[model samples]
Target: MKCEYDKDTESLKIELSEEIDMSTCKTLRNIMDGYIIKYSPKECVLDLEKVNFMDSSGLGLIMGRYNLIKMMNSKMTILNPGDYIKKILGMTELAKDVKII
Candidate 1:
């Protein structure tokens, strides 16, 4: 996972690799949470364009971030998720909680 924050836009973009599972979820969460705390971005964008697979852990990650951003009165968006990822998001009803584009 990669994280980038734009001060001008007050947005934080997180780019995930092809796969996200339990092995990486904890680390990813720590890093993402740290960045959020440090920057306090108004918008959080999860770039899933490169992600082809994700497990339940990935869903948890998204939900966790969604709640975190909401607590700050910020918004979270899932960007360009692949078909598989999109389906999982839909199945988990996470698509309704966050904007997907």
Candidate 2:
């Protein structure tokens, strides 16, 4: 997993690779949480175009960020997830929670 924070726009765009499973969820969460808190971005965009797999933990991370950002009146979006990931989010009903484009 990799994350790039755009300080100028207070935007955080995370480029997830391979699989977002139990193995990498902690690291992914920590990195994203730190950047989110440090930058206090008005919006967050998670780019999952490169991710090929995801599990429940991955969904948790997305929901956690959404709740966190929503509390601060910020926006969060998930961009370009593949069909597999999209199906997971859809099944979990989290697709409605974010802007997936």
Candidate 3:
């Protein structure tokens, strides 16, 4: 995962790749959490265009970030997730807290 922060826009965008599973979720979570705590962006976006697979741990990551940003009165969005990811997200309560576009 790669994270970019735009100070002018107050946006933090996370680029996720390949898979978000046990092997990568911890690193992904650390990267995302650290960025959020440091920048506290007004907008946080998870870009899932390159992710082909994700497990329940990925859902936890998504939900945790959603809650974190929400508590800070910020917005969190998920972008470019494929159909599979969309279906996974749709089945979860995390969808209620995250905006996917």
Q: Note the Cα lDDT for every prediction shown.
A: 0.88, 0.82, 0.89
| Candidate with more favorable, higher TM-score: 1 or 3 | 3
Weakest ten-residue segment in model 1 by summed lDDT: 88-97
- In the range 1-101, model 1's lDDT, one tens digit per residue, is 78898989999998888478999889888988998889989999999988877988999988998889999999999999878778888987677778999
Residue pairs with colliding backbones in model 3 are: none
lDDT of 1 at 12: 96
List TM-score per model, in order.
0.92, 0.87, 0.93
| Tens digits of per-residue lDDT for model 2, 6-68 | 778878787777578888888888878887888788888888888878888888988887888
TM-score: which candidate is best? 3
Instruction: Give the local distance difference test score of model 2.
Output: 0.82
RMSD of 2: 1.6
Residue-level lDDT tens digits of model 3 in 7-53: 89999998998588888888888888999999999999999999888
How well does model 1 score by local distance difference test? 0.88
